[model samples]
Target: MSAASERAAAAEGEQLARTLAVLRETSDRPLSFVTAGAFAALDEGGSEPLAADAESGTVIPANGLVLLYGDGGAGKTTLVLDMLVHLASGEPWLELVMPARPLRICLVENEGPRQLFRKKLARKLAKWPRAAETIRVLEEPWQGVSFRDEAQRDEFVEFVTAQKIDLLVAAPIARLGMQGGGTLDEVAEFADLVADVQRRAPGLAAMLVHHPNRAGQVSGAWEGFPDTTMHVQASGHGRTRILWQKLRWSSLLHGKTTHLLWADGESFTVDEREAVTASTMVDEILAAVLESPGASWTKLRPRVRGNETEKAAVRDRLIADGLLVNQTAREGQFRLWHADDPAATRSELRTGLERLPFPTPEREAAAVPVPPFQRSIGTVERERHGRPGSLVADCLICDHPFSVDDGSPAMRCRACVALTADLVTEREADQMRLLERLRVREALRGAA
Candidate 1:
């Protein structure tokens, strides 16, 4: 093939079409196998096992693009930094678990340099309790320019062809061009960019750090594109949780994991998972925790109505998840915990109210007027099947009470929906206040 033909074939814009064709053809079968194989072969320098599940390695193909999106202080950077160090140290993705290969990460971050990255990297590496030098961390901008004009797209395509990256990490896709597109449409365009990247760097897993939409969706090109999509959020008060809203190839889709992250002097390290609860409980826990450096689990547990086992489980889970840490032993009492870690705290602020302790209630499967929008609440409005008032309902987000009656259609109660909305708004406002305080504190410290 001529050099020109070779360049054209390598171009992401062109290759993306071919890749989509292949995807369609193999849609009947699992495409992950091919993607995983491609990833495994692309980088084979290190054979050491890092972290894996019993069934398979923790890292796999179609591990695709792991987008970690959060607000400014959501510890997104810290999490990436920690991962870089942890992977390098050959530490397991989770405690006692091992991966088949050391995670070879390429961070196209807009932050950090050789010194800062290394200093933070060192601290995180030490916390892993594993040997350093097992992983490879590469820091470079995986650039791609976009334009409304086809000529600009083609120019950027040529640039990507020149730099054949295995894993591209882009920060805030909003900052890509000279700024002239609608935000939502830009999001769609961004999603297309991700699709394009996957085509050219077939072996690469592009992880993008982004912000969430106002309606609480993974903002940009969100019309069904991610193989795995997770929302990293903090319980308004202080606990940090990363929930998998969508997972194409894994079972973590509905899975919610709490993460306690702390900076051990430099980069943030995630400790473990915490208890899961209804959205209200999450909001309450965060509210209580953020007010003070710590809150007694004893006093807080009942607010969420967790049993002894559940409370203990949440405590233990928090410690494991790296969202909470042991503050003091007090010689002979049940250990108390605090949001002592920076990563966990930052993550909490990042997610704000999105990850509030909400429960996933069963859908009617084919209910009319989607409850949130429907104005009715009880059987008086909708027929209760001629039976006595025996209807029970709950909020889709917080599992709070909604009423059911025998009249017209289905809906949430005034008090229940109002409470949910109030809680959500309160938590959000509280986060802003907390962030403001943090900002002031930082300014004072910097001035000093």
Candidate 2:
């Protein structure tokens, strides 16, 4: 090795040895112990193993690392603000009952400017004035405040410790910046930084808000470090759902979700929506099915436009429709496909069926009884996910999905339920057959 390289290595080794020596010299005697000590320690003190901090009934432990991540425009900012407001005010989170005593919370927004936060605060002020007073926002973060920058991290740790902050929010952690990387990549560096902070201030808990990658997973080493992970999603109509996706300490919140609505402009309100239950699943199923026609059970399962209450409603909506048929074909062991799709083989019957006009004549024919319980299953979807044309309905008999005429009572298309003057009796059927034979005989004689 070169002289300088060797010298540098020796210096690092000496520093490490000195640090170890200092730790050994200033440490408690016979410190390390086994499972018995852990058992006794647990038995001796501490109120509860873990308790909820900001979220009611949810335990966000002291010195815990939590990640609240979501898609780019999932309203993470609004949701996080609401959470902090509850934490500061000792209010229930969507009636989940937050900590009885409010914890001192600090939200350091690395992304949004002071103006944006003001706008947010102003919107929520009327409803959460008291909570707003307790929560603190740091507009200007110290330069180079990152795990990669030890000095800045140390300063932040000191700040958190001195302020007696309970929860510290680090937003868009990418802004924190990393120095270099290890074998495990950038996430390891982030974890190290967080560890350093926790060591300095044991009472300080961290909640990092981050964005998802293209594949919809939290970017970087977030999953590796945080003891708890909450997946946030925007469910449209200014509504957001924060799914407590994983928690290392507790299973009470596993698969549990909370919905938050952000109503802004002219007026502002943050409200907790009711969780989807069995009764509500039917409505959710109807809305989703309306959005996506011909969507099979497998496709509809993951497309949770609304919360899941009844698992069975996924298939029941179509089964209830009774108008549309499952032309879904199976590919190999598990994959399913739409059977009527030309991608497989275009059936002449299906083509003819789709081309037929709406059943205007069938509804007009008074003699024939209209099918009982005619559900106008709106426009036949050209492709499974294609937009529904105005007033779409399906044919009952041939299972042909068709567009219904506006204000039409007919469920079946004209082609499916052929319009005859009246329901044929046995003698009428025989007379019709005899007339057909006589016409064929005359045609043959003329040809000869």
Candidate 3:
């Protein structure tokens, strides 16, 4: 045979071998055979473990599943957007270094109307001109994505494959028809589906956004299935941070507990000013402590800055860092002394405290709007729900009687309290004045 024919025959044989190998790998086999193969592989020392290849350092692993979760409104969306910026600009994230080459990314969001998402995304990509070129967005609502159905999933999988998507972000798992509970098996099925997506598109990494439960944990067993788990939180004001991180493959991940200020919607930078402020706070705290050694928090409280939150945070950091110590033995005296010098303690603040009291919080959650009935309490009439007059309760101020109903509690009777935020108490000033005048006249008559 000619040399060219021999080469063609060799290529055909190689293709056939590959096809047979794939079939063998996919076919179910006896447990004993699998165990024997595993043992044989273990006995063979020549093979090496797979080398790690990250899409963006360890922040988003290549060809792996990651779940970025937080409470609602915790800036999970912001963090992911920032990540996209890094991918586009080849910029380093808080600690996650970007690869030299730019990655193609897609964000499938379901929480909002597309125009609003477009507006927000436009702001994020303002600085990076190249971002628009590589990032594909789907402002599709969660209800529209029937990922539970195989047909919908396959269509998406095909889209992912066609796009050659390096990183795919599907936010808010709740939106993707995976909203909360079914069974553990159902959760596992969802996880399997996510894995199958990766399998369908080799070298495709996914970052899923999810919300945490009341206990501050992800909703299901799917949490453990992700290759990496990032918990995002809004620390205070515009500041945000990664509350914690769990990385299975590489601890090369950054910012497990670093505060990040949103540079914009699309990016982040370390809250460096916060560090400076904290340092200043520590110095102020130290000076205050030195001025009156063993001074209670109450004593030094007056010296701290206007933001008591910063003050409390700095105090906690001091104690946590071993720069300060609480040495007050008596109750209600939260006195502080130098960690290095217990002997430098000063006298406690108060003469006596009933308990170790913390300052009452001045700030409150935004007040709930009072119902219209409560707003116009005097107008209309209160109807008794009970039989004729089973029992009656009188308004504390007006003495207006209304039948007490078991269905509603005393506190629920907003009409009586008129518990609107703007409500003012009315007093019988005229009656008091007349009584005072009468007493004065009587006294004058007696004296005369």
Candidate 4:
């Protein structure tokens, strides 16, 4: 062999020997190939799904890395804290079931100070005090440890194993002292480190919180590292929506978004009503346009129930699907029409409006169905002296015409008054139901 070839062979041999030595030192059992038969014989029933609901299938995978990312002040930490609390309490979170027994968790909070974390934790524990017993927080001196440092890594593994931690939460992965500059190599190194920890402490799941890029996406190659990736965005009115951006192993939550409403300090409740299915929203939009053809977006959006972002998204989707048509009307206002309509131009729509059965303003007002109990008791008077004594006045609430004897001042009709009373009663009943639900949840927690 040539001189250079001999030197290269010797260097490769030294590197392999060092690698083998490190593996031998770190591994608890002797290294051996996992044969196909042995792998097949392994117990599959022991594996559990991470953050899953019994009915909804797998959300996140167990013993694997998961990523949660969002913009600042988007309630990412709040959501995760709630989740960990539920897991610790052995209760369900946003319908996701937890283990029957409490799971040990180590929260590495890097963004906030210890006092701030304390306040947050206190609020979360107000309802479920038992969860506090299982959760551990590691705050300061976090930067001193890095996966690249063998001693530090070993210490971390020891801590995980010693505490019997089932889950490790690293808040804002950037703060973790993983020393590479968001490169492929850095991600690979982090993944290897996580795998090592998981192997050492079986059933350990790692959740890494991260920040998105300017375009609102996972910042780097770190996206590919997690078995599941979730994105949180603020939906209006103290509510946030979580979108499953990536699910490598399971397709259960793919394309499905979960919404959470802030109920109290550090508390979130799932708003199932606001979680309207896409098909339902589409149907609502189509029906609205069918009722009021040529309605502008400004007028039609209010009739829908979703936030502005969702409304716009569904609108764009409808247009793309060719289920709805948009045309520029007078003053550049965008007018929407059902795609099945034959009206191709503004003038055509106007002409068609006259011929179509679309209800006019007066017709719509007259179409309001008045209850039999609201029939006027007074007889209609043709005229008293020179003009009719009884005049027609529209109801202040329903706009239905009612007789005003001797031109009496207009007021809400009897039917509207009854309807208003019914609405108020319904609202009170809803409030009572909500309170009952809260009480039941508290009772269940106490029982557990």
Top lDDT: which candidate number?
4
Q: TM-score for model 3?
A: 0.54
Q: lDDT tens digits, residues 282-313, model 4?
A: 88899999989877788888788766787788
Model 1: worst 10 consecutive residues (lDDT sum): 351-360
lDDT of 3 by residue, 153-194 (tens): 677788888987778888778767563483577777566667
lDDT of 3 at 420: 19
Badly placed stretches (over 4 Å) of model 3 are: 1-27, 30-57, 139-143, 182-184, 252-255, 264-266, 273-288, 296-448
Q: Kindly indicate the candidate among 1 and 2 with the higher TM-score.
A: 2
Ranking by TM-score: 4, 2, 3, 1
Tens digit per residue, CA lDDT, model 2, 1-448: 9999997688557646754875787685676667976766775322332246333334676777788889877877777777777777776665543554677777777665667667877787668778766677765653334555556677778877787777788777767664332235557756656766776787677888877777787766456577789998888877777788777766667667766666553222445456656556655554555566545556656655454445554444434344223333322111122333332222245431121222244534443565423434344333443543324344455454444434354554443333221234346645654554453343334334
Q: Which lDDT value does model 4 have at 227? A: 77
Off by over 4 Å in 1: 1-63, 96-98, 111-166, 177-188, 236-239, 263-302, 305-448
Q: Tell me, what's the RMSD of every candidate?
A: 22.5, 14.2, 18.1, 19.6
Full-model lDDT for every candidate = 0.48, 0.58, 0.60, 0.68
For each candidate in turn, the TM-score is: 0.42, 0.56, 0.54, 0.60
Deviating ranges (above 4 Å) for candidate 4: 1-41, 44-46, 139-143, 274-278, 295-448
lDDT of 1 by residue, 1-448 (tens): 9998887566646546655886787787864556776876786532222333344433334326566676666666666565555554545543423434454454444443557756765666666644354343443333443332345445434544455433455565565542334366655655655665555444556666777778666665653655556577765534455666665444533354546555444443455544446444445555555554434566656655445675566555555555554332332122233454341222244421122222223333234445443223222321333443323444455444333333323344333333332333456644544554453343334334
